[model samples]
Target: MVAVVTKRYQILQYVSWMEPVGRRSLADQMHVSERIMRTDIDFLRQQGLLDSSKSGVVLTARGRDVFTSMDQFMNEMLGVQDSEKQLAERLGIDHVLIVPGDADQSARVLDDMGTALAQTMQVMLPLGEQIIAVMGGTTLARAASRMNFQLSAGRELTFVPARGGVGETVAIQANSVAAAMAQSTGGTYRVLYIPENVSEETYQPLLNEPSVKEVLALIDKSSVVIHSVGEALAMAERRRMSDDILQLLRDHHAVAEAFGTFFDAAGNVVYKIPKIGLRIKDLDQIPYVFAIAGGQSKAQAIQAYMQHAPKQTWLITDAGAAQSILMG
Candidate 1:
């Protein structure tokens, strides 16, 4: 009976994401036969939760409500609540929100995680003007993409890139993420165009630039921050770091990278990349700090960084990373 309910919940969840989707496509995605899927579809339609059209099946207004409530219900039934508390205590974080499924396994899971972040911001953001400093990465970009106008309807919010650009894909760069988020949420954004890692000779000159100084000031005043964690070597390689810098990370046994700081398993700062923007230590001053990352592969990196994370940091991740860290 429990298994049946779980399957039905998954079907509703997937349909909510991919409405107007065919039975064959849904079955293929769910890894089930069309005949079995048809049975579930018929049951849902009979219950008035789903309606069929020339295109495909879509949820009724009631179905939408049920889907929302069902998500919370299923999470509780599946022990996600227990996992959240346990993971938060174990990692010494102020809070932890673990969404269902492994993002690494399904693209929809990543989308769900993004939706979760937007929902959290709606509740945590206080009245009056607020600046949110955001970091770059595929994960952060997905979250930004999920942001809707309602997130900033009554709030005065400015989104600024937490750091300068890295040698990463253009869309996932800090500047891009900030812009996308601003556009989606009806907020304004400031861009920082300098390279994330720069030479000592160029650092001071860039800092003195009027444009850079303006953004830096906003970043320093930011009340909330949203960023992602990365595996140390993976991040270093993505930035196209020099061989010496790469070797330094390996030599120090760096396990994770967040913002510009790298940490080893012991949560010691193994290295700090030269960058202009929010430093990890500065998080202590911010009222709201959200570190978002997930995937079973990232369990170690998440565990390592959270060791040195601020006491106020709220980690938003998926079950894959949480289970891996807790079960280990």
Candidate 2:
């Protein structure tokens, strides 16, 4: 079958390039086992394409031909570029699927990113196991809008607002975005009812309330987090930050805003709003953190978030943002 051929071909390619590699190493790389590698190797050897010696196993002359064909196929499939691949690598992300163009092309890029993300989620997440924690923003809302709920059948998932966005505009509020995503995925949701920028006095009290407390507890348990980075200047304007706070951020050259916190490109805390929602410590506990944002304007924001983000965080952005990020 074509499926079986594809699997064996992949194994051969890995062994040929990573040859002199032991059974354990092959198993580890393929996330399989020594047994599986041995079986595949035996099959390859029988095909006369692989030869085994006392030292280790390697490709035979015939094997090299097969390796060349497979290598060419892989190159064609992954023929983006070294520079772009390096950008993804530098971000320490698993994959960076970029759509070409600039800020003016953001709508098309966002559509493509959303569709790709929806497809990726369908593949990466198993049925009845997804737990998404989301932030609210225009880009995120668009992404959620494009999700295919039919692909999530039998999934027992819940979407929770990553932070409070009660006072934010409807389109960019955490609760609104989470609810939209939940609706799109045919899942349920829990909202952070409290405002993102409540007074310190109000914040402590709200956190003690049973309703808010329950949502915060759920957020802590979330395994996946999806959020958008915000430019500090734009977010300050949106939040109506005090003139003094704005001045402080400008003085420090603050570039990004995340979960009510602002940071400069160097990862220094420029300013913070006392919000009653998920804390930075809580973000670290999640296994998958997807920071989704795009456009040249969001480059600095994305960079600043990447600097302070948890090591496991994965960034999803477009070519414009990626190029701007490298330039910065």
Candidate 3:
């Protein structure tokens, strides 16, 4: 067991920093010979801690849990000194988990939140036969990483991306994010193969396609929806909004954006981007809506989203953002 523990620790440490890496790099980092590193890696593979391919190595789903648990244990044992907890409590959220360091330290905090959110979905969602709708963002991507496929057993859950591509980054698109989450949960996924913003004339024709209509119908029937909130300015920048629309947002004092619609704190629609995806009214039909966002910068945007969210919605956010919301 001593050998097993040491190998696990070594593999965990290496993957934590040098993820998507190869066995050769792991050996070089540990200063161990290639032969020994190979042996250690093989052991970890047998234990399901390391997933290796011809290209590189990544932590398996099980391995992520081990690493996350260790980090959380160390942080709690060392104690957190951050002042963000007060902010979380004031926001009326269920719980606020804070990482006691700066943005660099908060990566793990975000990871933890993702894991918790995934676990929550696993426990709360009905086994099989549920439709889950998801939106895309950096926060949701992180949450996707911590999720595991084991939690979806005996469930026939179908995931559909709530919107379309926002920017050039393929990873942050709703279709890609929805696919990732579906894979993590051992469920199937459907992609919305269109941009978030399109002209009304373009959308009308696209809606006539059989595939688009099918996905749209599924989105309307979703029982649970998971999403991330975004600041209006940031989203505008991401979507490459026209100068006229930017000025319109400024005129309306828009603070937050969700599902192609921008809103101010009062829940009034500032502007609506013509996007070919799920409508805000569809969210109203869902029984459960889970909104996850973090970082101090997103506080106002999250607050704006909360103002418009249904009464049964649940929010998952970090202490940093929570504090900002409370202060505002």
- Please name the candidate that would achieve the greatest lDDT relative to the true structure: 1
Q: List the lowest-lDDT window of 10 residues for candidate 3.
A: 95-104
Q: Residues 1-328, candidate 1: write the lDDT tens digits.
A: 2355567778878889999888898899889999999998887675556788889888988667657855764675467757777898999986777788887898777777787777666545655698999999999999998888766745788999988778898999989999999999899999999875678788869889999999999999999999999999999999898899999999999999998789998888998888778888899899989888999988999999998789878788888998899999
What is the lDDT, from 0 to 100, of the residue 114 in candidate 3?
78
lDDT of 3 at 152: 65
Q: Looking at model 1, which ten-residue stretch has the lowest summed lDDT?
A: 1-10
Q: Which RMSD does model 1 reach against the true structure?
A: 11.4
Q: For each candidate, what is the lDDT?
A: 0.84, 0.72, 0.71
Tens-place lDDT per residue, model 2, 122-220, is: 434545567788877777888888775654555777889887764567876888888888888788898877765567777777778888888888887
Between candidates 1 and 3, name the one with more favorable TM-score. 1
Pairs that collide in candidate 3 are 128-155, 128-156
Sort by TM-score, top down from the best = 1, 2, 3
Tell me, by TM-score, which candidate is best: 1
